[model samples]
Target: MEQLIQAIILGIIEGLTEFLPVSSTGHLILAGEWLGFVGESSKTFKIVIQLGAVLAVLVLYWSRFVSLAKDMLAWRFFRKGHLDALHIALALLPAVVLGFLLHGLIKQHLFGPEPVLYSLVAGGILMIIAERTKRRVTAEEMDDLSYRQALGIGCFQCLALWPGFSRSGSTISGGLLLGTSQKAAAEFTFIISVPIMLGASLLDLYESRDVLSSSDLPVFLVGLAASFIVAMLAVVTFINLIKRLRLTWFALYRFVLAAVFYFFVLM
Candidate 1:
């Protein structure tokens, strides 16, 4: 019963923080520590629930994805109207390659409170700087992005491998600094998250297959379901809210969270 409650809490945390500039990984680490849920299985469970969040993106942007799929299937995805496929790939490439190379090292050394705390503080600073130094909005929509801009965002995404830095935060801030409008940057961020997070989740599940058991099924199911439902709501709300809410607010929130984490949790 206690474990199920913890699962639900963590699942909600994952959904809420996953797409936000705030880091879901950081929240989960602290939440798990508080709940006494630290273990190999706990880590696996956290990663697996991210799949539910990824599913939310697929559902929310089903038509867009279908269009991209149809274009790819027809071998026309590289044409003028279908550049999103290439853009997404460009935005994902650097992080994917770097993450693959550093995966084991990150899991071994950086998956801890101290690393997360430092990342949270550093990421917040980066977001603030991005906002202040943002250039004129050249890309009004994701489709307007140039390949170089997409790759630039991808390089920023490499920072997210440090756990609490946040993929959305890094990429969106990169977009802002690279001349993409706030809405466009956010749309690109959410869209690109799908493939990267889904792949990572699946990889984690595969590696942890030996430790998983039927007994853990209920907790996993509840967490996944909660994460999916909440993520759907969060994505929609965030999309609508991004226009009015500046990235600075989220950055400030990260600072507060980091301070609290250090004082209350780490102490």
Candidate 2:
């Protein structure tokens, strides 16, 4: 009974942080450390709950996602629609490969409080650097994106493999570096999430096959419910927040988390 309540609380935190560029894995690690959910199965539970948030993105962006597919098929405007989607796919390929290769290590060691602390600080520093550079807003819409640039951004995103670095954070920074508008980068980041989260969840479920079972199904369901609802809300709020707020705020958060982690873990 006690475990169930704790799991629900973790679910709420996972769902809200998963979508924003705030490093869901980092938060989960910190939460797990604080709540004594440091075991292997409990850690995986944090990741598996992301499946729920994945579905939320699927449902919320269904119309646009489908349109991207349909437009790609129609080969409109010389197949720019299809080509752009292909570019996104290309960008995701690196993480797909690296993620599977590092799956076990990431699950066991990367999500630990120590690593997460440093990752938070490093990621925060990178965000500040990216923010200070400049905002060019070169690509107004998806159609304006290029394959070469997409490939470049995709390569840049590979850096997020560290626990607290956040896939969205790396990708959005990639887009910003390549001169994408804030809204466009955010929109693309969210859209790109469908594939990335689906891939990660699938990999996690596969690796955790022996431990996962019907007995634990109820908890997974509850976590899913929490994650999906809060994720949708986070998505809505995050998009609005990105436009109005500066990246420095998130950077500050990372620095603060780093300091907190250092004090708690080292001292």
State, as a TM-score between 0 and 1, how close model 1 is to the true structure: 0.96
Candidate 1 ranges with C-alpha deviation above 4 Å: 81-83
- Runs with alpha carbons beyond 4 Å of true place in candidate 2: 71-78, 81-83
Relative to the true structure, candidate 2 has a C-alpha RMSD (angstroms) of 2.2
Local distance difference test, per candidate? 0.87, 0.77
Residue-pair clashes per candidate? 0, 0
Q: Each candidate's TM vs. the true structure? A: 0.96, 0.91
Model 1 error, position 68 (Å): 0.5
List, residue by residue over 134-232, the lDDT tens digit for candidate 1.
Answer: 498888887788888889998999999898999889988999999988788888888888999988888888878898998898999899998999999
User: What lDDT tens digits, residue by residue, belong to model 2 across residues 135-245?
Assistant: 667686655767766776677667777888876777777777788766666777777778887777777878888887776777777888888888888888888988888
Cα lDDT of candidate 1 equals 0.87
